[model samples]
Structure formats: C-alpha cells, structure tokens
Target: MSKRSSISRLPDEVRQHIEQRIAEGQMTLDELIHDLRERFPEHADDLPSRSAVHRYGQKLDRRLAAIRASTEAAKIIREHAGDREDARSEALTAMIQSELFESIMELQEASDEEMPAEKRVGLLSKAAKNIATLTRSSVTLKKYQEEAAAKARAELLAEQEERLEELRGEDGMSEQLEDRIRNVLLGKA
Candidate 1:
C-alpha cells in the first residue's frame, strides 16, 4: 500500500489554514514553518518539508491568480452589458484576445525547452480557439439571461393583473351593497 505524503496526511483544516496564510503573504516561509511547528506541536515531526510547503504555496498562488483573472473578465463583460450588441461584442473580443495573448506569453516563458514543438503549437491553437469561443459565448449568455429576465418580468406582471382583477371584482360588489343600503335607509328600496 502507498503511504500518504506528510502534507497530504495533514487535516484539511490545517492545510486550509496554511494555504490562507500563504495567500495573505503575511509571513515568510521560515516564519510559516515555525508557526506551524508551534501550532501543531503534536504533529511537528509529521509536517511537510519546507520545499513541499513552498511548492504548495506556489500552486495556491497560481489558482488564486486564475480566479482573479476570471473575476476581472466577468466584471469587464458585465460593464459592457448596457452597450449596443456590436459594441459589447467588440469589447469582449478585445478583452479576451488581450488576455489570451498575455497567457500565451506567460506559458511560453514558463514552458520547458524539452517540451515537444507539436504539443506547444497544439496548446497555443487550443488557447486561441478557447478565447474565440469565450468571446462568442459571453454575448450569447448575456442575451439568454436578458430573455429569461424579461420572460420572468412578463409572468410576474400577468400574475399581478390577475390579482388586481380579483380585488376590483370584490370592490365592485362592495359598492353595490353600499348603494342598496343607502336606498333602504332613504325608504326608496
């Protein structure tokens, strides 16, 4: 049977705490190690090596960066929502293309020279296609959401009209009763 790595064996809560600390950038690696040792004295010997912690921190940072990028993209798309359709599409396409270019540059820099040329080309092609698809999807998604919202608004209005009609019918009957009462009181019934 395979044994779990020290980092993997740590409780989820502990790992989460470490990741949070790493994300905050409030402490150095040595300080982080010391703090963990102090906090989990019982498992001090079971803690991951400094290098493992550093790797984990790097991975966490990458994930966080990706999330931030996605959020920024979403914000950009939403900000263009009130624009004309063509304007919105152009804005989205520009934004996505710029991001894709930056991502390709970063990937090229990070990729090892040992990586196959074919694989690299394939990756770039896929990324370009993905950016194009994302640009198209963003516009389509906004249209669908707007349609759904309008439909919901229409349904709500219909329901309200039905309710108002029922209230108006009751109001009319009440008025008729009041008129009859007035006639009887005047000895005209």
Candidate 2:
C-alpha cells in the first residue's frame, strides 16, 4: 500500500478549510503557511508541506473543472430540449394559421360581389399556396430541432461516460460503486 500523506494527519475540518481556500485561489503555499503560522502558532509544526498543499490544490482544481464541464453539458441538453418544444409549438401554430387563412380566403371570395370570378379564384389559390409553403417550412424546422436535441443529448451522455471511465481508471474502484460516486459528484443522484 502507498504511504499515507502527512496532510491526512490533520483533522478533516482543517484539511477541508485549507483545500477550500486553495481551490478558491485565496492562498498560495507560502501565503497559506504564513497565515497558518500566524493564526495557529501552536500547530506550526503540524502544518502540511508546500508540495503537499500544492498537490491538493491541483487535485481540487481538476475536480472543479470536471464538475463545471458536467454542468455545461446539462445546460446544453436543457437548451436543446427547449428548442425542440418551441419548434413543435411553432409548427402547430403555423398549421392552424394556414387553415384559418384558407377559410378567410373562401369567405372573402363568396362575399365580394365586385371582384371578377377568375380574379377571385386566382387570388384565393395564391393565398392557399403561400399558406402551404409556410406550413411545410414549419414542419421542416421542427424536424431539424428534434434532430439537434437528440444530438445534444447523445453527445452529453457520451462525454459523461468518457469522464466516468477516466475516473474509474484513476480510482481503481468497483464499477458499480464508482458509478454511484460519479452520479453523486455530478449531482445526478
């Protein structure tokens, strides 16, 4: 087994406080050692070495980076999901408007006594064609949005899976337990 770190000898609370400060970029090793010496003179000899503290800081930075990437992936998934819903709603509205326009064209043709029969028919046909084109465009937009959302979700899952694999390789833990830990760390659990 590997030797235990000297920093591990410190109380959990103290260790966490030191790590938190390091992670927040609030203190460098020299600064931390000086502050510790000043604040807790009694434990001056027990303070961690500069290299140990630096290693801990680097580890914390990696964890923070992983967490941020996971959060950004989730945000992308949510945005794409919202876009898909918006596309579907727009398509539905377009279809409804097309039907309404067609109905209005028929009513206008029947009610306008001054308009010639051939001219009225031509105008009605043109309006109907325009509405059909809009409806088709909406349908196409909805399909594209659906595809984008699916792609986003798939990419996010793949990225999380890769990160989990890397964590597993580094940790050498049981797959099931590592998965649980990964979920908890990523806030999925």
Candidate 3:
C-alpha cells in the first residue's frame, strides 16, 4: 500500500511527543481546551455551535489523552520503580494504606453505633418478638403452605383433566344416542 493511502496519520515523532505530554500530565483537558481556543480563535463567535462541536470535541480529546498518559505513566512506573524505596513511592504507599485503614475504622464505627430508637424498638418489642416467633414456628408450617398451594393447583389441573375426559366420553355417548333415537322414531331396519 502507498504511504499516502493512510488517512489522517500523525508522524511517529509527533505521536510520541503527544504521548509524553500526556504522561507528564502537561496535556490535560483544560490545557487542550485552552490550546484549542488559541488555535481556533473564531470558534467563540457562535456560542451554541462551538459548545456543541468544538467544546465537546476538545473535552473528549483531552480525556482520551489523559487516559493514554495515565496508562503510559503506570507502565513506566512499574518498569522503573520496581521494588525500589524512593521517597515518593513510600509516601504514596503510606497515604493509600492509611486512607484505607481510616475508611475501614469509620465503617466499623458506623456499624457499631446504636441504631435509631424507632428501628431498635421495631426489632426488639414484644409484638416484634411474637411476630418473629410466629414466623419461625415449625418448618412444617412453611412447608404446608407451599404444599397446600401446590395441592390446590393439582386439584384444579385434575378437574380440567376430568372435564376433558367427560367431553371425550360424550363423543361416543352422542353416537349411541343418535342410534337409539333413529330406532325409536323410524323403527329398526
């Protein structure tokens, strides 16, 4: 394929430069927006059109660049900072762990706090206890409820089957009746 056949392609050097800017956090959404405005100076004349296309496109480009940069940075960090004890790495690790610990403690404290009076009373009252007792009464009660419902469904199904059987029997019964009626009204042949 001819090199010119490739559509809207950036040179490798330009692509690398952009990727580097992203990794260094220099190519942010805000920076992209500012750069776009500076480059496309006429875009601000019509607010609506600019807002729809120019602004949104700039924002999207910035977000994509930031994501690329972050991925590249993570790769670089993993490769260069492997098992190293740099001050920055230690600080980041300590900060993350402390934050996690604090969050866990806060959650535990929330769970241990006395519940609201209304909720506590609802769960622990004599009436609530009685209801709980009734609900928990023999496993057979629960089983029986399910069984009774199933039995009712089976009874309805059996009734339908019986009705279908009666209808089928009537087909023969009808033929017998017709023969008897013909014999009575117009004598036997």
- Among all candidates shown, the one with the greatest lDDT: 1
lDDT tens per residue, model 2, 25-87: 977789987776787677778888888888877877887896687567556656776544454
Question: lDDT per residue, candidate 1, 66-174, as tens digits?
Answer: 7788667667767866432434455555667777888788667654554566877788899978977886887786786687678867786677656545655744647
Question: Please, what is the whole-model Cα lDDT of each candidate in the order they appear?
Answer: 0.73, 0.72, 0.49
The C-alpha RMSD of each candidate to the native structure, in angstroms, is: 14.7, 30.2, 26.4
lDDT of 3: 0.49
- Rank by lDDT (best first): 1, 2, 3
Model 2's alpha-carbon lDDT is 0.72
- What residue pairs clash in candidate 2, if any at all? none
Once model 3 is optimally superposed onto the true structure by TM-score, how far is the C-alpha of residue 110 displaced, in angstroms?
Answer: 18
How much is the lDDT of residue 99 in candidate 3? Answer: 49
The residue pairs found clashing in candidate 3 are: none
Per-residue error for 105 in candidate 1, Å, reads 24
- The best-first sequence of candidates by TM-score reads 1, 2, 3
Better of 1 and 2 by TM-score: 1
Which window of ten consecutive residues has the lowest lDDT sum in model 3? 1-10
**Which regions of candidate 3 deviate over 4 angstroms?**
1-132, 138-140, 170-189
